[model samples]
Target chain A: MTYSTMKPKEVRQLIREKKITTFTSGLCNGYAQANLAILPKELAFDFLLFTQRNPKPCPVLDVTEIGCPEPKLAAPGADIRYDIPKYRIYRYGEMTDEVTDLSTYWRDDLVAFLLGCSFSFEGPMLDAGLEVRHITENHNVPMYITNIPCTPAGVFSGPMVVSMRPMKPKDAIRATQVTSRMPSVHGAPIHIGNPTDIGIKDISKPDFGDPSTIYPGEIPVFWACGVTPQAVAMSVKPEFMITHAPGHMFITDLLNADLSVL
Target chain B: MTYSTMKPKEVRQLIREKKITTFTSGLCNGYAQANLAILPKELAFDFLLFTQRNPKPCPVLDVTEIGCPEPKLAAPGADIRYDIPKYRIYRYGEMTDEVTDLSTYWRDDLVAFLLGCSFSFEGPMLDAGLEVRHITENHNVPMYITNIPCTPAGVFSGPMVVSMRPMKPKDAIRATQVTSRMPSVHGAPIHIGNPTDIGIKDISKPDFGDPSTIYPGEIPVFWACGVTPQAVAMSVKPEFMITHAPGHMFITDLLNADLSVL
Candidate 1:
């Protein structure tokens, strides 16, 4: 069966059945794929406030009620515990387990948060006739830790993490205009020209994800990434937390067009 | 000197000195004007969450630090207590006082929130060659409480309130595209054409502001208004709250162009 041509529900069912336990990239092309972050109820309010304070880094798509596995808004009737291809468990800020399902670790006090991912805007960027360097080479987008401090909310406080994509200056301008319409999906680029200006010491070395090829005329453009929230959550050293493994996103029922302001 | 030609600081100084205690419409052309909401620090977190959950109705421009009278980000060196042309004080949701200065009610525990007003986007709408009906008729935009319930956060919850601008179908489309770029101000029309669909019983009678002129070829286009937050706050009936008097806005030093996502 072709995964890209299948509906979001079908793709989710395959993941739940363990038939598709892999990265969700290139699947469910038109639907939004969101990053998952689950936290205990004790820290839910503060975590929600943190996401609220830092929208660009953590643009929330849907937040499940306490202990509920189903995401009510983003994908009604979809089970959060089993739908994602892979899950990462963190205990006291240390990665303790990686699982395909959360049945063993499921707790009644856990609240699930689905955050907007850069993948949502990449589709539009590609459609706008711009080349996505990372996708073209089939590698992860380069990500760096920035000096920009996210507004502290309760216990959640840290510098922002950003993903970089290289494009020609003219294409960068068009990409900015295309992505600005989707504010829920990281909006516009935060920094357009120089990576060093935002505290990145080297453009070739990234803290997370793989490096991209920068053509002679291309400039590195940086955007607030979903990784920032996960990084912030880990930095807080919470008793327990859950997030999706890199590139293994939660497929939502919402269309990319649904998020467009225009 | 013409108020329009004066800098934001000069206009703020005049308001601070009680020399200009009137509606601030059309004064300080390129700069952004803001809606004011002052609440006790105890309720600041929940109120901020409310705005976060419903950004269309409450696009926050600057939030002052707890007990600080200065809006440090939006207008540096401007006093929140006396810079506005007029102030409205609410006691248990009742409008008990309309004062020019906050000297009598000033408290150390108060927190001020500056929200983006529609005035910020109107300049661009006019520049795009679209007629702002309310401005053309010299009246406030007609507003109505809609049936659409806001995403509740904490204790703050109420129906979404929308301000209407009547325009031809072509102009309405253009207006939407123009305003969508300015998300800090209400981004785009929540509902267009029928007022009854959103629970507006009478188009001629608005809950707040004046009725707009609907020409033969024009349809009512609604944008989420700043009034929604104030109305929601009143519904909560906090022990003490303060807001700007209708038509009297807090002028910010930030340019309207600064809020554009593109």
Candidate 2:
């Protein structure tokens, strides 16, 4: 079946039935895919504060009510527990289990948060004719943990993580203009030229995702990555946490165009 | 002294000295001015959540550390307790006193919050050649309470209050495009025309501020007002609350250009 051609609901239904169990990129072409984070109700306010403080890295798309599996704001009528293709359960900051569904682990005290992902902005960048190197190379975008400290919230604070895409100076400026309209998806590049200035020692060696090729005349541009929140959550070592597996995301019904301000 | 010609610090100093005690609409030229709110530490988290849930009306510029008298992010050297031209003290949801300095009532548990005001975006709108009716008439902009309910958080929930600016259809469109870039300052219009559509019954009569003139070819455009958070705070009726008197803003060191996304 052509998953790319399927509607977001159709894709979610397939995932719910255990028919599709891989990552969720390239599906629902024009729609937004969100990064998921589930935590106990006790930690929900602090985590929400963290996202509010560090908007660039953790732009909140939708937050589910306590114990509710449906993301009523982002994807109404869809069950969050089984909609995502894969979920990683963390116990004391360590990945203890990888699962396709959360029926056994579901708890009434859990709160789910859907955060904006860089994938949403990349669509507009590509539409604007800017080169998204990772898409061109068919690899995950390079991500680095930077020295930029996220504003500390109760038990949730860490250095911001950034995703890099190598582009020419002109393209970088254009990309900035393109993404600036989508503030919910990590608006604009944090750094455009020198990676070392932001504390990224080596351009080629990234802490997460695959490294991208930087051709001649192209410079590395970085944006706050969605992984920072998940990483911070892990660092805090909450007793139980659930997050979408890398590259696997919760597809929202909101179109990419809906997020643009202009 | 010409308030418009003086720098933000100069204006703030004059205000601190108890000399220039009036509305601060055209002061400091290009710099940004903010609305101030101070609440107890216990209510800080809930108030912050309220602002987060309602960014359009309550776009937070900077929040001071608990018990701090200065807004570290917006104006490093200025004292939040006394720098603003005037302040209104609220006790159990009622305005008990209107004072120039909060030093008399200062407490160790207070938290200061500076929210973005529409003045920052009005500069751009005027620069774009769109008519700002209230500014032309030399009166406070007309504001009304709308049927639109703000996203509730904790104990904060109230109808949205919006300020109206009359403009031609073409100008309204341009104004929307212009303000869309300034999200921190109540970005874009929530309603463009027909006040009754948003539960506003009479055009001339407003709940707050002076009436605006809607010329024959012009329409009343509404932008979420910074007054919202304060109104919500009043409704919730915390034991103690402090807010800048209407039109008396807290001047910041940051320029209007700094808040522009593009």
Candidate 3:
């Protein structure tokens, strides 16, 4: 059976059983998929405050109760500890291990946070008739670390990171209007044209992710990247953390349309 | 000088000095006004989580660092303790005192939260040429406690409180479009037409503010009220809590337009 046509619960169950241990992209099409960030209860409040202060870079989808694995609002019955296809363990800023299940690592003081991914907005942008350059080029969306400082909360503090997608000026305007309706996902383009204005030294060499081709007459439109919270959290060097490995996301029951405000 | 034309900083200065101790309705006209809620650090995480879960009713504008008096993002260099016209001190869900400054009651564990008030959207509604019944009649916006329960966070859960404005069916649609762009303030109506559908018993008598006239062709429109957080927080009956008394609010340096997503 095609994964895109399956229910979110079915996909989650498959992942939980370790039968589907690949990246979650294109699975459960039309449903929202979220990035995962799990921290000890000690860092949850500061990390939550960090997301609140830098909302564009870090739009939160749901926050599980302390010590709970279920993301009650985003996906009621799903187990966050096992629902994702892959999990990366980060200890004090360094990635220590890759695991599929976190039963052994789970603690009574852990809090899991589900953050909205840019993937949620891509479908809408495509539906709006705008060609997403990275998708067209079949490469990962280019990401850069900008000099813009995010507002600090407690021990959490760092620079803003943005993902770039090149688009025509007219399409850029239309994309802004389309994504602005979905603030729960990264809302709108933070920068339109000049890359240096926000502190990107080289367009072709992104700090993370593969660089996409920027055609003539098309500008690099940037949106606050979902990588920000993870990057910032790592900068603080907390004792321990768990996150969904790259492209391996937690598929939510919510439709992409549910994130739209209007 | 007319208060409406003055700068937000100037108006806040006057309010801090106790020279203008009344409801801050028309002062700093274009700037955004916020509802205040102060709690000890012990309850800050739960309250913040509550606001996250129930964003429509309790849209957070800014949260102060624990024990800090400045709301750096909302109003830089301004003291939250004395910026508002009046504050109500609640001890275990009971009203104990109303004071202008929090200096006497301030503690190192206190954390102040500034939530978006409905006042931020009224300007856009007026600009859209819709008649706000409460503003036109010189009365407070009617508010009611609904039977719909808010999604609970630890130590915080209660029925949602909503503010009502009577308008024609067409106006309600337009108002939804107008307000949906500003989600930081309560965005869009939760209910329209019938009152009892949301558990509002009486159309004339409201739970909080004064009721406005519902015209022959007008339907009562409801938006999640800012009172939800305060009411929910008070229901938990913390040992100590503080909130702005009624119409008196914390005026922020941010313009009303700043809150708009589109």
Which candidate has the highest TM-score of all?
Answer: 3
If scored against the real structure, what TM-score would every candidate get? Answer: 0.87, 0.90, 0.99
User: Can you write out model 2's per-residue Cα lDDT over A147-215, one digit (the tens) per residue?
Assistant: 999987667889999999999999998998998998878998888999999999998999998999999
Full ranking by DockQ: 3, 2, 1
The complex in candidate 3 yields a DockQ of 0.78
Per-model CA lDDT versus the true structure: 0.88, 0.89, 0.92
Error of 3 at A255 (Å): 0.8
lDDT of 1 by residue, A1-262 (tens): 4898789999999999999988898898899999999999778766876786677899888877667798867898899999998999999999999999999999998988899888888989989999999999998889999999998766789999999999899998998889888887888898998787899999899999899999898899999999999889889899999999988999999998888775
Candidate 3 residues B1-262, lDDT tens each?
Answer: 5999999899899998999999898888899999999999999999999999999999999999999999999999999999999999999999999999999999999989999988898899999999999999998889999999999998899999999999999999999999999887888789998999999889899999898988799999999999999989999999999999988999999999999997
Name the weakest run of 10 consecutive residues (lDDT summed) in model 2 chain A.
A64-73
Q: For all the predictions, what are the DockQ values?
A: 0.27, 0.36, 0.78
- At residue A222, candidate 1 shows an lDDT of 91
Best by DockQ: 3
Q: TM-score of chain B, candidate 1?
A: 0.97
Ranking by lDDT: 3, 2, 1
- On TM-score, the stronger of 1 and 3 is 3
